[model samples]
Target: MISVAAIDARIWQAIVAGAFVAIGWIVNGWQNRRVAAALRAERTRDVHRALYAEIASCLANLDSPEALAAYRDAMAARMRDDPGFVPLIPRERNDTVFRALVAEIHILPRVTIDPVVSYYSQLFAIEAMIADMRGERFRALEPERRIAMYEDYIALKVQAFHDGHFALRMIDAYATDGRNGAMEEEARITREISAGFDTAGAAARAASRISSPGAVRSGRSPE
Candidate 1:
């Protein structure tokens, strides 16, 4: 038979060994959790960067005030004879990154997701209008109706520019951890771009007004 003292010593040793194993397991789990969190944060930031770059590129393609002016001029020049004329639209774009990672967009800050979705939605609308313009339905319309459609297309494009800027502002703020007075800088950019749009519109209207007198003098209706 074992002595009581010997049995008590064996039990104490078992308890100590089991306590060490449990402590080791808890520490290992904690370390794993910490590493996983770090990786997750890094991945989120990477997603933000990719999205920011892609959206910035798209916005750059559409943000040209000069391009907008050129389109207006080209349309005005062609409207009398080429009623079917279409203004220059950006090449159809694919939101590859956004499509691939849409499932994970939720990882973005809650406030950001809405603007991101909104911008993309505007882009899709623009693309759809571009597609429709290429179809026979657009060509079949009267000249006046076709002009109305073009006006609608320009309105949509302008709205997309505003939306793209807004999305970029939100993403930039998130990427910078909401520091560095980014909002003020973004606001200035927004204002400038908006002013560019306004200036282009004003110039186009002035040109139309100037041309109207010539049409009146020539006994022809202004286009």
Candidate 2:
């Protein structure tokens, strides 16, 4: 027995309530999406920052001529002291970071991408050299053969490390801003990056000197 006017008023109230609820839901969802997008951006930045630093540090370690010489000498000593034992030099590469960046590469700057790609490509070449040197046949070959061929591998590693430093510098250049202390900090970092490249270059030059023709021939030597 409700009046027609009362029925219409109730219907209008229901409709108004539903409309408000819908609007509130949309607003909340939109805000959540914005927050999530921001968090993702921050995470991506963090990943890149960590990746650049790690690659630089790893290259520095690998391109250390003193460390390489020490490792070589240690290996020789171990062979003499324990003929049955073998030691492996630990290899470091930013593979995880690389994959992560590749997954989100669409968001990265094009200039940044090129240097990063070059750095990784160089690393890949160095890795391939290492893999070839560590193959079963390689170990079975004459020790002299190994020594002769290792020069080129060392050269590749050094050059790859040098490229990694270059890539880091490129990234630094792009990220720098003319803010308080930013220029000074960037200059300092650039100097450090340059020093890394110098170390790698020196290592490459030394290895190149030892990359005699005999080494090339040894690559095709019969077991």
Candidate 3:
């Protein structure tokens, strides 16, 4: 038979070994969670960079009075020929990646997120306006009135131009410098657009440039 003292010592040793195993398991779980979280964050950042770069490219493509001119020319010709034409708005952003990472967008820093979301939100509005213009009711309006309606869309184009510039700068900052730099760049771009840029005048110039042979399609970069 085993002595009681000897039996108690064996039991205590077993208990100590089991406690060590449990502790190790817990530590491993914690380490795995931390690493997973880090990986998710890195992936989110990468997605944001790709999306941002696309938006920056779109901004570069559309920020010119020439691009807006092309659209106006196309619309004027469409009004004359197609008669049921829906004027094209200049919003060439790619949102497929953005939709794919919807969950990660919520986790991103708000300073950067705000600009991106704002830019896309305006695009959504432009899309809605486009649909409305294409509807039967808008097309039924007199040709002169139709032209006037499309001219009123100058507001949307001008606002979008500024929004694109601001958002792209914010995205570039995050990709290049950092978030703090992104916020600063955003603020500066907003001020610059607000002060020196004549939104109405630019739209007017673009519209004026649209002349005879207004067959230029939207989406082509200006020369």
- What is the full ranking by lDDT, best candidate first? 1, 3, 2
Candidate 2 weakest ten by summed lDDT: 214-223
lDDT by candidate, in order shown: 0.63, 0.57, 0.60
Q: Write the per-residue lDDT of candidate 2 for residues 1-223, one digit (tens) a residue.
A: 9999999999999999999999999999999987777665555455446556556555645756556667566666655566444335345455666775677655545545566788788778777767776678767756655654565666666566666655555444444421223335446656877776443454333333322222121111010
| TM-scores, one per candidate | 0.70, 0.51, 0.62
TM accuracy, model 1: 0.70
lDDT of 1 at 58: 65
Per-residue lDDT value at 222 in model 3: 10
- Candidate 3 lands at a TM-score of 0.62
Query: Which of 1 and 3 is ahead in TM-score?
Result: 1
For candidate 1, the lDDT comes to 0.63
Residue pairs clashing, model 2: none
Q: Taking the tens digit of each residue's C-alpha lDDT, what string does model 3 give over 1-223? A: 9999999999999999999999999999999987777765566456555555555554544556556767766777778787666554433445666667777676556656787788777767767777777778786888767877776665566566666555555555554555566667667766866798643333233323322121111111111
Spell out the clash pairs found in candidate 1.
none
Q: Which regions of candidate 3 deviate over 4 angstroms?
A: 1-8, 65-94, 100-104, 142-144, 176-223
| Model 1: per-residue Cα lDDT over 1-223, one tens digit each | 9999999999999999999999999999999987776666666666666666667666566655457657755686687578666555445774788888898887765546677798889878978998887777877878777777777887777776666666666555555534233455456556867777442333223222322221121111101
